[model samples]
Target: MHIEVSGLYKKFGDFQAVTDVNFEIEKGQLIGLLGPSGGGKTSILRMLAGLESVDKGDIVFHGKRVNDLPPQERGIGFVFQNYALFKHMTVEGNIAFGLEVKKWSKAKIKDRVAELVELTGLSGFEKRYPHQLSGGQRQRVAFARALAPEPQLLLLDEPFAAIDAKIRHELRSWLRDMIDRLGITSIFVTHDQDEAIEVADQIMIINKGRLEQKGTPWEIYKNPQSPFVAEFIGESTIVEDASSLRGFGNASDWPGTKALIRPEYVEVGKPSDFKLLSATESGRVRHVHFRGSEWLVEVEVGSTRLVTYRSLEKEIVHPGDEVQVLIHRAYLFNNNDSWIMENKLKEDPMPVHI
Candidate 1:
C-alpha cells in the first residue's frame, strides 16, 4: 500500500518534535526514516502508526485518511528496537499472539504460526523461550510476531539497534530479503547511516525536527541538497576560507561559497607524483588511524584539519610527514548552503603549482 504524509506536525509540551514533515512511500517500497536521537524520527513513525495523534496534517494510506484511526485499526505491524517479545512465552506462542488477539480460529492461527516460523528461520526454536534464543533469533521472532497479522504496512523502530554489530549486519540483509519477498510496504527507523544505505530503497533524513532530504542512498550521498545533508549523510570536510582553495581550485567563480570535500575524493602522495596537478596543498600529517580495511589520515593545513581515507593496500604514511593533498572532486555551496556544482578536478582541471 502507498502512504503519504502531508504537513505532519507533532509537539511535546513546549518543544515541537516534527515541523511540517512531508513524504510519500510508494507501494511495496521499503523506505527508511533515518536520523539521530530525538530528531523526531520516532515521533513521525508513531504518528503514522497511529500511536500518537497528529497535531497537524493528514496521513493517508492507499486513499483513506488514517489520522483518526487507532493503531490496531490501521492494519500496520510495528516492531520495536528491544524486540518486545514476551519473556515467558515460547516462540510459537509469541508469533501466534497477534492472530489470537484478532480472534483467528485455532487451526488458522496454528497454520499461520507454522508458516512464519519457517519463513523467519525460527522453526527449530519455536519451543524455546526468548532468553534461550540468541539476539538475532529473538529479532526474527519479533519480526514473525509483527508479520503474523499479514499487515499491509510494516513499521520498525530501530529494529537492529539492540543486536551486536556482526549480528546486526546479518539481520539487515535478512530483513531486506524478507520484506521484498512479502511485498510489504515497510518504513524502518534507524540512526545508522550504513544500515539505511544498505537496506532501504529510499531514505528520509530528519534533523532538528525537520525533514532534511529524501532520496536513494546514492543520490543523498553524491548530490546532497544542503551542507547539513552533505555532512550528515557521509564523511565531509567543510572549507570556509577561500585561502584553503589555493591548491584545491579557483573559487573566483563562487566567491564566499563554502566547499565540501569528501575523504574518498582526496588523494595524498609525494609532491613529485603529481606532474600536472591542478591543485596541491601541503599539510603536516597530524595523525594516522587504522579503520579496519582502510587508514584515516588526519592532516593539519594551517588551522583547518582535513581527513582522507587511504587504502591499507597502498603505501602508508606516518604522522608528521608533510604530504601533498590532491583534490579530485569537491561540492561547492552558496552562502545559503544550497549546492552549486560538483567540480571534478581530474579533466581540464584547475591548475595549482606544487
Candidate 2:
C-alpha cells in the first residue's frame, strides 16, 4: 500500500503531540518511525491505523483519503508493543481469533492457523498459553496473529521492545526477512537506532513532535541536515570549539565553531601508526572498555572528550598514555547552516605544522 501523509497534526487537549508532519511510503517498502518517547511516533502510527483522529491533515492510501475511515475498514493489521495476546487462548486460538471475527469457515481457520504456526515456528506450541511461552515465542504468536488477517498494511509499535536484547536482535532479522517474503507494506516504531538502521528500508526521524529528517540509514548518518539528527542518529560527540582540533581549519570557517564527530571519524593510536604523524593531535587516553571484539577507548584532547574504537589485535594503550589522534571528518553545524569539515591533511597529505 502506498501512503501519503500531508500537513498531519494532532493534539491531546492543550498538549500538541504531533506537528505538521509529512511523508510518503511506496508499496511494499518497510519504513521505520524512529524517535524518542512522546515524540508522536505512536500517535502517527495510530492515526494511520484509524485509532486516532487527525486534527488537521490528509492520510491518503493509494490516492484515497482514509481520515474518516474506521480502524477495521482501513485494511491494516496492528501489533502493539506489549504483545496483546489473550491469556486464556492457546496459540492456535489466538492466531484464529481474527479469522473467526471475520467469520471464516472452521476448516479454513484451521488451515490458516496451521500455516501460520508453521511459518512462525510455533508448530508444536499450538496448545500453549501466553504465560506458558517465552517472550520471544509469545512475540511470534502476536506477529502470527497480526498476519493472519492478511491485511494490505502492517503496523508494529515497538514489536521487539518487550524481548531480551539477544532475542530482540534475532527477531529484528526475522521480522525483516518475513516482511520481505510476504511483501507487506510495514511501518514499525522504534527508539533503537540499531534496529531502525538494520531493518528499515527508509527511516523517518521524529523529534519534538516534528519531522526532523527522513532518509535511508546511510544518508542520514553520513549527511545529517540538522544538529538534532547528528547527535541522535549515532555515537557522536559534539565539540563546542572544534577549531581547537588540528587540521579542522579556523573557528570562523564553521557555522558556530561546533562540530559533531562519530567514533569512526576519529582514529587514535601510537605516533608511528600514522603517515601524517605531524598532522595528528596529542591526546591522553582516559578510559578503555572491552566491547567483545574491539576496545572502546576514550581520549581527552584539549577540554573535549572523544571516543574511538581500537582493534584488539593492535597494541593496547593504557590510561594517561599520550597518543596520536586524527579526525578524518566532522559534521559542523549551527541553527542556520550545516556542513562537513574534512581534515585538511586528507586533501593535502602534507604534514601540518600545528
Candidate 3:
C-alpha cells in the first residue's frame, strides 16, 4: 500500500526526535531509511509502525489516516534487529504465533507456517528452537514469522545487524529477491551506507532529526544537493577556494563558495608525468593504507590533507613521497551549500607511463 508522511514531528519531553519530516513510499517498493545512530531514523520508523505516537502530522496509508490506529490495525509486519523470537517456541510455533493472534483456524495456521518455512528456506528446521539455530537461521525465522500474517507492509529495523558480514551479504540479496517475489512493500532502517545503496530502490538520508536528502543511490551519490549529503554519501575533498587550484579560473565573482572533489576523480603520480602544470599540485604523502584491492593514499598539500584511491595494480607510493595531484572533476557549491555547477576538466590528465 502507498504510504505518505506529511509534516511528521515527534518530541520527547523537551527534545524533538523528528522535525517536520515528509516522504512517500510507492506500493511494493523496497525503500531504506538511512542515517547514523541517534539521528531520528529509528524514531521515524517506530512512528510509522504505530509503536510511537506522532506529536503532529498525518500518516496516510492509501488515503486513510492511520495516526490513531494501532499497529495490528495498520496491517504492518515488523521484524526487529534482535530477531525477538520466542526462545522456548519452535520455529513453526513462532511462525504460527501471528496467525494465532488473529484467530486463524488451526489448519490455516499450519498451512501458512508451512508455506513460510519453505519460502524462507527453513524447510527442515521447523522444530528447531531459536537458541538451537544459527544467527542466519534465527533471522529467517523472524522474517517468516513477520510474513506469515500476510500484512500489507513489512518493516525491518536493521534486520542484518546481528549477522556476520559474510552472511549479511548473502541475506541482503536473498531478502530482496524474496520480497520482490512476494511483491511486499518493505522499508528497512540501516546505518550502513553500502547496505542501503545496494539494497534499497530509494534511500532517505536523515541527520539531526531532519531529512537531508532522498533519492536513488546513483542520484544521491552523483548529484548531492547539500554539503552534508555530499560528504556523508561518499569521500570528498572540500576545496574552500577554486582560484587556489592551478587550472581553475578566477573566482572573484563567486565569493564564499567551495568545491567538492571525489577521490576517484583525482590522479596521483610523479611530477614528471604531468602534462598540464596548471591542474597539478605537489604534496607529501602522509600515510598509505592497503584497502583490500586498492590503496588509500593520504597527502598533505599545504595545510589541507587530500585522500586518493589507487588500484593495487598501479605503482604504490609510500609515506613521505612527494607526489603531484591532478583534479579531473569537481562539484561547486555556493555559500549556502547548494550545488551551483559541475567542473569537468577539458583535458584528461596524461596517464603515468609505468
lDDT against the true structure, each candidate: 0.87, 0.92, 0.87
| Per-residue C-alpha lDDT of model 1 across residues 186-206, encoded as one tens digit per residue | 999999999999999999999
What would the per-residue lDDT of candidate 2 be over residues 176-230, giving only the tens digit for each residue? Answer: 9999999999999999999999999999999988999999999998888899898
Span of 10 residues, lowest total lDDT, candidate 2? 248-257
Which runs in model 3 stand beyond 4 Å of their true positions?
A: 240-242, 249-252, 272-275, 340-354
The residue ranges of model 1 lying beyond 4 angstroms of the native Cα positions read 247-256, 340-354
Query: What does candidate 1 score on TM?
Result: 0.93
Measured by lDDT, the strongest candidate is: 2
* Candidate 2 segments exceeding 4 Å error: 349-354
Residue 339 in model 1: lDDT: 56
Best by TM-score: 2
Q: Candidate 2, 174: how far from true, in Å?
A: 1.1
Clashing pairs in 2: none
Residue 3, model 3: lDDT of 96
Instruction: Give the distance in Å from residue 32's predicted Cα in candidate 2 to where it truly belongs.
Output: 1.3
Tell me the TM-score of each prediction against the true structure: 0.93, 0.96, 0.93
Count steric clashes of candidate 3: 0
